[model samples]
Target: MSKVSLKGLLSSRGPSALRSLRGGAASALSDGERLAMLDELEKSGLGWFWASDAEGRLTYISSAIAERLDVPLADLLGQPMTTIFTAAEREGRAKSLSLMLGAHKAFTGMAVRATRRPDGAVLRLAGQPVFGTGGRFAGFRGTGADISEEFHREEETARLARYDSLTGLSNRHRMAHQIDSTLTAFRAAKRNCAVMMLDLDRFKHVNDTLGHAAGDELLKQVAERLTRAIDRECEIGRLGGDEFQVMIPDVDDRGVLGELAAKIIAMLRQPYSLDDGRCVIGASVGIAIAPHDGVTCEEIVRAADLALYAAKNGGRGQYRFFSGELENETIFRRRLEQHLGEALREEQLFLRYEPIVDAAAQTVQAVEAHVCWNHSERGIIDEEEFAQIVEGSSLIGDVGMWAIREACRRAVLWPDSVRIAVNVPVPLFLSENFVGEIEGALTEAGLTPGRLELEISEAVFFGETSIVDRTLANLFKLGVRMTLDEFGSGYSSLAYLRRAPFDSIKIDQKLVAEAERHDSRELGLVRAIVALAGALQMDTIANGIESAPLLAVLSDCGVRYLQGPIFSEPVDQDVLEQEIADGSWKIDPGAERTRRARRRTVFRKIEIFHDDYAYEVTLRNLSRTGALIQGLANVPKGTQFVVDLGGGQLAVATVTRSSGDTQGLEFEQSLVDDGSGGLCTRNRVSPYALASAGTPLAALAPGSYQGMVGGLIDQGGAPKFGYAPGGRGD
Candidate 1:
């Protein structure tokens, strides 16, 4: 309709009609004045007014909109309102526009994008339902305003809130809300969800040495790897700093989660190429499952955090499942950390040397320096435990420098030909004064630089190339040999060999240990590494060679140097000096090769039973095959009994040797290997079994599974052996 026709309609309806149309905002204005104001508002270009008939066809629209839509008013007037304006995708308000129009209900501020506009225009529509005299449904008469700019601005704001600026992954806030919503829904559905908390092991070192730009670049690369490693359905978020979280829905199996965690760790541990830096960082993951581990956000997150702490504590580059035990252990770890600082300050720390011998020459050519803590109150602490206590702490660098200095000092007492191999932590190796520190130690100790070999881990290869190369060159110029330690443990990048100036490769103990387990694939991998090292003109040393068979295998595989318990445990500096004075010491690789099961001389009390009686026997020596039990007086040679190995693990054993209160019992079936290199039973006594036996339980606790043993113990009867009630009388 023309402007003259609109004015005529308002005049025909009088001022009362205009007042109702304006919602009484301009009630004092006359009919002609209101009509002029409405006409001017439509022509102002700020907004447009539209009227649709009962069938949803546009009866009237501002002439400007009709022109903007590239159609004449007559042609546009007959078209369906839905055809002219459609809901923009993902706009919440616009999605329900059609439904609201269909309901003939009054609605306001419904956002919709114009279908005919070329610029992808968004409009906000507000209208009240227009009814006929009979109260019958007519159509909507709404005002539309251009909100395209505001719409995009809101969208960008939302994106910023949800995404990480650096890696473009989800941010922590988004992850928290996502996890909260998912867990809530999953809990109602009685399904499971898992959360993995990961932290980069050496990320801070990258930031400190190469600057935050390289660290940010490294994190971006890490995020990309994480995306590839995790399932597409899983939600990954950068939880600030070097921390990240992954949410996997419909997964509760520890085994599957473990594999996923391993994949993530392996992928992230790969070398990252920054602008001018080659960065490598390892990740530790802690996984928590819903219902089993926790049910709510805080509970699950805390569980995962605890598990992550445990993983880092158990030495980085590993994953751990959340368990109740970690709660108590975390407190102990804090105490250990505090004590470690004191130990370093009080000079209670000492060094032990494990000889790295040439398998072919049968001579000790070098010794790897291991730091040990002689805690005044806690006795001797092993390297693994101490490493866990000091990892990610400032004390590590102090201890590392001390180890390097002490090793150099001690090397002066050894033969000039004997080299001292001291481990260089990634943090220490990337430090600004690493080369200076090495030179200072060598100068102070009066030791030649060549005699002080530096053992650098594969991790050090993942930093700024210029710095790492410069550090390596400086050490090389000083005549120090750089051996790449733990070669295959992380990325096993052949790229390191191509670019790095490593003089030798220390084959990771895992590969050697895996070879002993009869894994042909692992054996082939070890051989391949040795062959690769040989091709590169770098010597390969096999570590963790405890078995003679593995030793023979390594020797046959053409490995030159070897280190492990087979030769000797790491000895003190005094003993090391004595060994060096004795000249070359060698391990006899052919020394009585045996496949004997590893036996632990544990003196703990264990339950053994035969027939209807259970005996509290003292475990002397235990192995996968059998156990030596004391306190069983008249046990026959072939007497059969079940031994409770704690944690619901039970083994049926038969007495093979018996003398007085001591008997050697053999297991009916072999025990299965625990993932941690420990042993557990192939089958466990189920909680259902315990319940069926009329003994109900909430959960099985350690040592509480004694009741799970079949048959009743004759507790009222006389003692089985002639020993004190609490004493193991030998």
Candidate 2:
């Protein structure tokens, strides 16, 4: 043990022993010397040796590992080698240890994690198959070196590449690859995959008001909410900066996709309390289905992106499914936006007024000024279309100020009692000189400030609290009545009502439209809003009152003023002035009768089937559960027929009334909502079902086939009744 003794021992050691220790070449050393060298190597604890039998059972293991693993040598011997070492380990490349041992192949530098060792050592293993002199299958002998630290470092590097550092979700690159791979695999399997593109609404506002740090924190919370909202085996990724994408596999049902999209929108809209302040934002989702919307990654993603753009343009905070019509809409919107800048300069923009009638007095109370754009080519674009074009544009303020001035000027020509109401967008109303602009318009037009009403939306609540409050207070002090527009259309806050001092609330047309339906809850909501308005000393204006029944309901509900198609469509300034000069415009109390179902007039060809024979008839009107058909002569009452609506929609109906060539038929089943302002059959003819029935279908192409056994009839032979080009038969 002394230094002199150790020096003498090393001096006596042969060159062969040193060479064997260095593993240069095999030395002709005695068995005792070889055993001593192996013991010295095991004692060094830098490396370990392992061997397995032909059965993949551990036969030998270094004592150092055995001691480190805290397992007795007898306990480890004859155990499955896979039990001691984890499965496929990843170094530069990954190879399954069990597979390599089973194949008896040579492998090296496989980073394997030790399962038995409590220290969780990652060992770099090198193994070569050993065979007997007879060339029989033998076992594996491998050397392992601990590389846990190195493995973790490499894993961290890989993690950075695949995940978002801020949110810890998949990054853009990873999401794209994931969608591509999933869609590719699902395409071959004839499965469906859906991709949803989400954009956070008002995220930039938060980032601007608070800071990037708060925005980042908000995104983390959004990611968490998304993960919880989906609750499916889908890939959710942050596609950088408030845009996220979700790849859902094996889901093609629009209903399910819509529900998920709604859930995500709702979850993200909840208020987030950051370190600085509380903020709320919404999400818009665009969904595209594989093989239907597109097949390729770019195609599908582009489709979804277009849908997202449409959703955002459609007034934000909603989900839209990709359809062929959306592309045209997007293009039209872009062109309209371009044209909108020139609208005011070219004198194409003008204001029209729809009369607001006092329900009790049955007299004109006010007229809302709606901006109308008469495109040279398109001719009379809807207000909504113009809104979509001007939304979020600087030109909106110009146009808005022009409208205010023009409406004030127009109001000067009207009778003293009739007031003029002009809608003020949140941006325009919150502008620095909004109050000054109102005053300027009034002073220039020589109109009373009280007659000029500024209609503001609840979105003003989302702006700077103090600024919005001050702006509204200043407007109120300017002798202008400030009415809250589109009440209940979004997050209507009680705090906003209590703080800003609004004079009236316009019940959103959506609520009014829904109240006309059979939904009692919507009616109750309308009643509550009216009662709430009354309690706050604010008047309620029922909007979109197209039906006489809705008018009666609102009148009975004590709604003070009304504005809709029922009273009048927006008229030019001349008509509005003439109506005002001709005394008062009173709405007829008994304007129309109430009906159970809403009917839309139509003039299109519809195929009718009776006793295996198809007849071509003109559809004069349509409802959810019935339709009136002309050109079908002598169709007796109670005769059953199948009406072929377009897009594989079929409705079985029985004739309830017949007079000559005109007949009314009642549907066997009610139609479901098409999500747009239309009705469709709940079920459609599936391509797979058609293929299963021996029909050759590449996909569900448009058009109908007459005289085909399984296809819906498009046309029929000469009809029993005389053919009429118009709905009425001679």
Candidate 3:
């Protein structure tokens, strides 16, 4: 193409003209033509334009350049380009000019800013150098545009991405990225850092009860407070909905970090002024230190999370540092979770009976069934070790059902007068299906609802009060007695005491245990709790009574019941039953001996009949209370019988109670001694008449009586005889 034609095409083209200039006809133009071509290019609508000679002087300047500087083009031509730039841009522009003139190379897309002479409007300029005629630097030409608006837009977009729109604080995404980068830098430098995860405790309640608008205002205020508390060296972020993260970079001493955390806690301790004039909320902080507690971002976050859980679990609004002990506890908890399914399926869980004694009666009133796990290797694990695992897992409801069923089954075996209290997990208490499970268990076990007591921890009351009220109301409707466990440990003391349908409140061991040891605040606390329970017309059971002094204190405090090792240790069901029987059983020689002789005669023959199928026997020495058969064969209880007399005569007999080979039989009519000693006697004389002879038959011997009566009493205590029919033995 001709030089003028090429220059016209390049000028007519846009930024794409630079690509064509790289290796095409635009390079074949003469130096003057290139300069003239550059001069013509300045008239294009893009922006200011300029041309430089091979000597690095300004050869041509377009009217647009003068207009950008607010000067005439005739006054700007033939001046070195460096003269047009400000002192700041002169050196850079001069270097570009030198490179173009010395090496015949072209440069493009060099961004520079210039100020207009009169109005001082800021203008962005981009320049390119042109070469021609034996590879000489003919001129430098470029365009510029006003990009202030574009620059501002880019900055605004970046700000929105990094900051939370609601609170105007860094969001979790940006915080995470910054923390990760900080950790990487710290690791390379072998430095230490700390991360704090904060949870606004009970913030949800405020939102639900007060309103979301109020909650939003509260969060904004919290963010402001946090920002003011932290310095430029530290960064704070809102990790979505009442949770926040703080990063303290380059922390060498952990104590310093702790002090900082303490400061944060103290700052949060001051009440937050919510939109609702005076409502306040508190925050819990969990701290994890890098290189000490964790080495990676995830590890640090997890450690902080665990510490946060510990803080909340220890009753919120506090701060805790990640420790080795907590890590070990976490591992132990994971192990428990791993094995919990098997434990539930294999029936490895059992109950221990903690006796609840009636302080007034000074007798064992009832036993509370405390579930325990008999781990094969770990021995017995405490509730704290596995209860949370059960609660946090889907197994909570299943485990609760199993506990209720097993407790009911074992409880039915207890003496009818003694009620058995079983601890129902808090989740079970909240579940809608809890009442159905209890009803089903009671039906299957044939246990009365009055005999079964369900114990629930005080934590349930501290939860959603509405939920607690509804759940407890349903449970009460099921006729199950409810005892509030760990009564004084929760916040909603008076509220729960007034609202819940609790039959009793067991004083938490903490207050009771300290009541005897210390005479100060703890004693007063216990006394207050007892007084509260009493005022509410609810029974109070003093727990953790280890010493007589504590019991005495409990008694003095007017506590109705006491539980702990002081009265009786938690024992197995069989052991508890044996203990109760041992304490209550009496020995009577005369009555026992007579009963035994009759029982032995009856049982021995019953055994013979059972072994040989001999079904008939004669009962002599009959009385209103009992009857003895002299020529009777052993028969099982419940067997119908017709006693044959003489000719077509007959007497109907029914087995009432049996012992081994002998059976206690009831006849429709009492057998009377005819005194004739004729056919009625017939080799079977009444044992009473024989005893009167003073040469009583072997059936009337005291030795046989003792053996039979003893055996009968033993069998009577068996669970299988729950509803055995009584029999009067002659």
Candidate 4:
């Protein structure tokens, strides 16, 4: 019915080819000429003809198409049409190829990919069923042309539309579409999905200090690292600037989510080597689970945002699960940010000094100055409580310079042997007057340059090569010693050490803890750092040595300076003066300085449920990992009990040790800090869940949940383990 004239007699390749077939002599050419022209057209690489028998076997295929497909015409002639063309989407071309052939119907414009073409050679095909004189159906005769070039162009355009050009990760639009589609499908199936929001810390600082080129380079590296870090099934995307989103399907357990978040943070925190210089950055993660946190995309995203804000407020480089209280916490952080500038103006801030000691001699080497706020109403707030808040403030430069000046002013009054060290913030260290400010502080207090130490982190290296190099050279010539603060917390690049004249390396405290807890490769890394520092004629300091095991390991590993609560907590100037008033202060290596997991002794009566029976118990002690409860008799190990810790909190725990009237319960999921020096569950049973159980989500009696959840009302028998007289609270 439809016809296209041969432009050059044509050619065949991947699809089908015209062999001995001839078109109707519609033109002025004779039948032989017309047939010759059609054959020439097939060989011109434009189009080809193919025919199949009644059994759907390729009965004839032109030599041009066979040559294009890299097969002999004889080989392609007898192959099944379905076997000759295969596609990834078997639903369309492949399925229809089989179905349409069997249906004995004409099909036009069927696009399919050749089975043998790894280059994804596509062909547009049109076919008509052939019938004999008796009207018995034969197979199909068709013409197809390769459309690989056009297909690849359209695919590239679509990829550019959905992917980030800079990072090659999914773009914001694609991520949003994916989240929406996944959540919708999952909602009906009653499955859980989770969303994680991650924002890079100090990314803008990198852009401001280094050039935009460096920032772009940093983002690409980040994408690669993120891909490697997230081994689970998920989609990672860049949602513009330094923000990223991760959609994880079929995950709702906060404990598992916490570990994954921690892994990502750890990976991102490692220092990155760039052409500009080596730099280290961190990420804060906020997570929200579907249906549990929200039922819609908007709701889930907002929940994740609130959680992210809370993580930033808590200190960057941490993860937080969404909770109802995060909304209020985010607002309070905003209020706190506004008040920070006021705190500075009102002189509500003070300084405390924590000593970094030479562990072998048990003598103080240097005391680092820290900022503390004495709010008129909120009492005292430490640096950890407000660090991230200050980092985001416009007054970071002012605050950094103040700490340096104040530390010098106070240290000038101490004995000459007691050197003072001050922390340098990223923004302040990059400011124009950074070196000038330090010089003025030293001059004003009559403090010798040698007696002052500048503690700088890897973040300072984000500046331009010339600027960072110039700044370091100027400071080194000024006669002050420099220490790399929080080493291994971020970019632990040996590249920086190769050039920067740091007098010492302060190992990140968390690195030490992680190394000791797991005896992981981190311990080897710590040793390598110590060896490297020793070779470079630099000292290595490992802080936060809490336990005896940790201290012993660090000591044996040749760490030069150790600082932790085990040595002495940060102290007021008055306390420091009292300790060193006579001579050089010395602390003997004693068991008292190291920290042990703090257990709070509690004598409160609570309820524990087992097998739908509730037993009144007295809580003897509580810790983050576990709890001890009295008032149960003959409780066997491995039994699970839900502890009602009052105020709608329920903790799932298992009995690890059972003695006569007391049981030590190990929590299935560890407790999280409640921010008031207490422990609480990360997530609580929501009112919606209660409502789903047939009760209205309103103000019900204190014990109303017991009947709905524990079936306590239906139980008329005594509990399995009755309360014993000795287990009662005194």
lDDT of 3 by residue, 1-730 (tens): 1122335445554434545344344466655576465556556645444555656565544456556567656555665655554322321232343443455455554433332252233345445656565866555555555454554565468777888888987898898998899989887776777898999866886788678998899888888888877764888899899999999886634345555665666566455556564444667778777765667899899988988876664445557666556767667766776787899888898877777878877677778776678898878865434554565566776777787898889878777777888777666777766677888999999999988888887656535667778777877888888888876542334656667678888877766766886566877877787788777778888876666666777788889988775665577767788867744311111211211111211122221122112234444444322445544334456654444332112344556876643456565544332111111211222223334445243433221221220111222221221211222232
lDDT, candidates in the order shown: 0.76, 0.76, 0.61, 0.77
Q: After TM-score superposition, what is the CA distance of residue 350 in candidate 3 from its true location, in Å?
A: 1.6
Candidate 1 clashing pairs, residues 3+ apart or interchain: 279-462, 280-462
Residue 157 lDDT in candidate 3: 80
For model 4, how does the per-residue alpha-carbon lDDT over 619-657 read when each residue is reduced to its tens digit? 999988889998778887877777777544577787899
| Best-fitting candidate, scored by lDDT | 4
TM-score of each: 0.67, 0.73, 0.46, 0.81
Best of the candidates, TM-score: 4
lDDT of each residue in 1-730, candidate 2, tens digit only: 1112212322344453234234557668865675577667767987677767788888667767766656667777788878877743443466777777777788887766657663566777787776765988677766767676787888878888988988899999999999999878876776778899999999999999899999999999999999999988899898898999999988866667876887788688777889988777888888887766777899999999988888787667778877667878788877787877788888899888888989988799899998989999888865655665677566788888989999999888878888999988878877888888899999999999999988998777778787898888888888998899888764566777889788999998877887876467888888999999999999999887777888878888888998777767678877876777776777664555334465666778867665445567888998888889988665667777667775435677778999988999898777654333345554434434445555443433323333332344323432343334433222
Model 1, backbone clash pairs (residues 3+ apart or across chains), number: 2
What tens-digit string does per-residue lDDT give for candidate 1 at 1-730? 3432456545654654455467767366666676788888878887577777789888667776666556567766767888877776552434666787898888876877667663576777887787778998877767777777897888778888999989988999999999999999987776778899999988888899789888888888888899999865899999899999999998765556776887888788877778966666788998887756677999999999998888887778888877666778788777777787788788998888888889888789999888888877768877656776777576777789999999988889877778999988888999999889989999999998888878888777666678988888888788888899888875678877877777899988776877775557878888898889888889999887777888888888888999887777788887877766766666565577445676656778776555444567788987788888888565556666667776445677777998877789888876643322235554445434555555433443223234553322333442343332433332
Positional deviation of residue 614's Cα in model 2 after best superposition, in angstroms: 11
C-alpha lDDT of candidate 2 relative to the true structure: 0.76
Q: What does the lDDT read for residue 85 in candidate 3? A: 47
> Candidate 3 versus the native: TM-score?
0.46
